[model samples]
Target: MPVRREHRTRTATRTNCISAINGTAVGAGDHAAIVWPLLCGVAKAKYYLMTADFIGGREAERIGLVSLCAPRARVLGRVLEVAAQLARGSQTAISGTKKSLSNWMRMAGPIFDNSLVLEMLGFLGPDAREGIGAMRAKRAPEFPSAKLPGAAQ
Candidate 1:
């Protein structure tokens, strides 16, 4: 019973978070449209538009979605403040330095296998028992840590 409530709470949080980032204009299935541009903004190193005056922007900041935050009404003023500072500074040097470092980081590969390992383990783990139970029960998982090697019995 507690697990079901927790599952619904988590799901609602996820859905609300997505809806906050993506306004109703693009609708549900087309959420990817917003995501691609946001990634492009990050790659090009620009501050992407905040979907909501408060909520989505908060989540974005939590996830490195933006460079800074302003009061919900002060966005333009905040932007101008940064722009004027940058305009007066050494733009060429800054641009070149950023380009070089970003390019270097982008090329660092033999891409870490962290993602693949996590996915594999998440599905195959003995610790995943509760998760699979939740899945079969049409609920979210609540696995115990007991199966992990260092966990206390």
Candidate 2:
């Protein structure tokens, strides 16, 4: 499943960009216990390098941070190849191309939001209410008649 985020696009999301980046998260109390003589920023960064792993690495990709993913044995080689490509390519050209793509698809955000609202509205209708109630009650619910009472007249 893709990571749920309001700030990104589907194509922009690669395996790394989801909740795929495995890392340790410390709550308020835990942070105080281990992180001392260090502020929040430093502590967060320290925690990342210390606890990050590949089990669910794509998590971090949700924000367009991770560039690629590979097995432990080949990660370095893949990184090198990616680095070489970037080095050989025109930085400005790539940047502009990506920027345009992002802007064009960004409008999908509001469309999804409206669609979700419409779906929920449907769920709140009598059909949905009957369907859910029937499921919870362990019986099939009856749907309303497809036609109004006087439609054939």
Candidate 3:
């Protein structure tokens, strides 16, 4: 679905003013190791990413993961309004500010790359197969990794 498509197509140059209308947010790709910690905080990011917990829009905003939450019907309009406001500002100033803020993520680039490598390794393992199967079956994954001796249940 849409989440998978988003994960595949997401680009770094996209505007960062995220607004969620409906549905839960899960840490995906480099977002878990890099973007989430920068948006929210380390503790909040760790709690959600490590648990793979789904966070609703309102809670996401409250936790600073999202810029705002809007009603489903109003989401597009709200986003366009924010865009228009940005478009009216001094482009150079906005671009400079954005670039400066993005340096935070740039500093974590090596960590993000390492996490991506680990994520790819996970995809090659049995747990990934179980995770995909569970998603397809609409059930909880009995991850093969969790079955190892002394592993947490």
Candidate 4:
């Protein structure tokens, strides 16, 4: 199924801009270790690291982020179609597959726990304050260097 973000106008998410480029960059720990796996999964983590996680429909489809791509106007129809298809499939198989995936992710529960702590540490840092300040001021954030102890250098 295709999962997409809402971006109907010129305005888009600041997270993408912040993460993709240097002025909008996040430190290695939060982006790489915490947010990456939680949001993009392990296999696609490298691409997100390089792109700062900015992805749209076509790009998402290209990288297997989404199973399908369609114009914004068609998103609902597409979702319905995909849902109907899945609904018609073997209910037991679908449930089993979903259960397996959930179990696999749960196996890494401890890692996710660590990631949350690391991310919270970022939230309490100077850069996080600067990011909020920059947003309020409608200016680009001047991110400080990623110097969190134990973060990759």
Best-fitting candidate, scored by lDDT = 3
What's the distance in Å from true for residue 41, model 3? 0.6
> What digit string (tens of lDDT, one per residue) describes model 2 on residues 1-153?
132253454436422222222234333221222222122344444555344433244543432234455566676676677667766778778666767666644545565455456655867788788877888999967756345577783
lDDT of 3 at 136: 100
Collision count of model 1: 0
lDDT by residue (tens digit), candidate 1, 1-153: 443344334423312121122231322222222332444454322233323233355555665545565565777777777667766768677566656544533342222234234445766876577766887899855666535577667
Better by lDDT, candidate 3 or 1: 3
Best of the two (2, 4) by TM-score: 4
RMSD of 1: 14.8
**Tens digits of per-residue lDDT for model 3, 33-143:** 877888888999889888777788888889997788888888888888888889888888887787777677667767766777787798899999999999999998898
TM-score of each: 0.34, 0.31, 0.78, 0.64
What are the runs in model 4 whose C-alpha is more than 4 Å off? 1-44, 47-53, 146-153
Candidate order by decreasing lDDT: 3, 4, 2, 1
Lowest lDDT sum, 10 consecutive residues, model 2, at 28-37
- Give the range of the ten consecutive residues with the poorest summed lDDT in model 4: 1-10
Q: What global local distance difference test value does model 2 have? A: 0.49
lDDT of each: 0.46, 0.49, 0.74, 0.57
Clash pairs of candidate 3? none
